[model samples]
Target: MPRIVDRDLEALRETALRMGSLAEAIVAKSLRALATADPLLCKEVQEDDLEIDRLDVAIDAAVLELLATKAPVATDLRFVLATKSVATDLERVGDLARNIAKSAARLAAAPRIELPGKLDQLAGECTRLLRRALDCYADGDPERARRVLDQDDLIDASESRVIRDAIAEIAAHPELSSQEIDLILIAKNLERVADHATNIAEDVILIAEARNLKHREKLERAGDRRT
Candidate 1:
């Protein structure tokens, strides 16, 4: 029975990894659509999101079944719980990617405005962060997950720069406000992708170290008060 349970857990991990890969691909393709203003690419991203939604539901059901039948404990329990959390984050990443794709589709019909370089940089960083987070989850490496956490600030900073530049462009050319607003929405969606990646990394750390990094800052402040 123990051997069978272990095998089932491994299967769940593989399924979660596959879902993560699909989510990453969707985000990358959405960014490409945004860059080229390709309505076809945006359509592809929207179609891919349906698969992500299916996978999310499948993972949740698997987790529940595993818990009901096997009653996993200790490390196995952590892995099962983390898989659910990671799946949820990946689902949200897919939704954000779809939102970006929608914005890209709008931009496709509008007059092309010169997008800020910072937006490109932010897109690249968010993609890299998400990939790294998935890698850490696959490897069960808390250290690599921590590195993903460290790079999230870079995404936030780049997003801020993109927003500031887009706002300035809108102010200077009010006639272009619609297109500029679409660009701003794309940047916001990309930033949210980075946030979901951060959440996945935090879950990876929980699975590996049994330490919840999600509330580390708040917990640390509380501890300081006690001291």
Candidate 2:
């Protein structure tokens, strides 16, 4: 027989996972819309965001309820706290996807220009990172979450390359400056999505290991590490 608090915690986990899955799908759809230049798909991404927002509210309520009524401590407390942060990150990821979709729609109206640099590759990597981060959360695998953290730097570099390439393109073809600007914005939104994914991965590590690795690099440099 499970306690009520245990059941509630499991329910909260399920809700978080559901929200994460929806967010991941929204990101993929937004990227597809950008690649195919489909305004209809852009609208769909916007519509999906409402659901993400709702889930975020629900998760917040649940977290508050658990804290006020359940008195969760130790690992349970960490899980609840981390889930709240994860929900916030996922909600922002949804917003970033919507922003990308809007930029895609705008680009669709303008004359087609070759996307500068490895924009497509960057989009793919960001989406993959998001999916993997969610998977680590679901599995409660701190080791795998740490790996996801390591991949953020790669996505950051890719975004920087895209921006540089788009700047060069704008300089070369001043007439297409508007479209180039949109491309830069889309690249930035994708980079933000990757950032949210990394944050979620960090939360997963916190939940599983009871260790705060968000500032792991600085701690390592200063040799102030504690296990």
lDDT of 1 by residue, 146-208 (tens): 899998778888998999988888899999999889888988999999888889889988887
Best by lDDT: 2
| Model 2 TM-score on a 0 to 1 scale | 0.93
Residue 140 shift from truth in candidate 1, angstroms: 0.1
Q: Lowest-lDDT window of 10 residues in candidate 1?
A: 1-10
Top model number, TM-score? 1
- Candidate 1 is scored at a TM of 0.94
Clashing pairs in 1: none
- Per-residue lDDT tens digits of candidate 2, residues 130-157? 9999999999999999899989889999
Q: Rate the local accuracy (lDDT) of all candidates.
A: 0.89, 0.91
Q: lDDT of model 1 at residue 149? A: 90
Count of steric clashes across candidates, in order: 0, 0
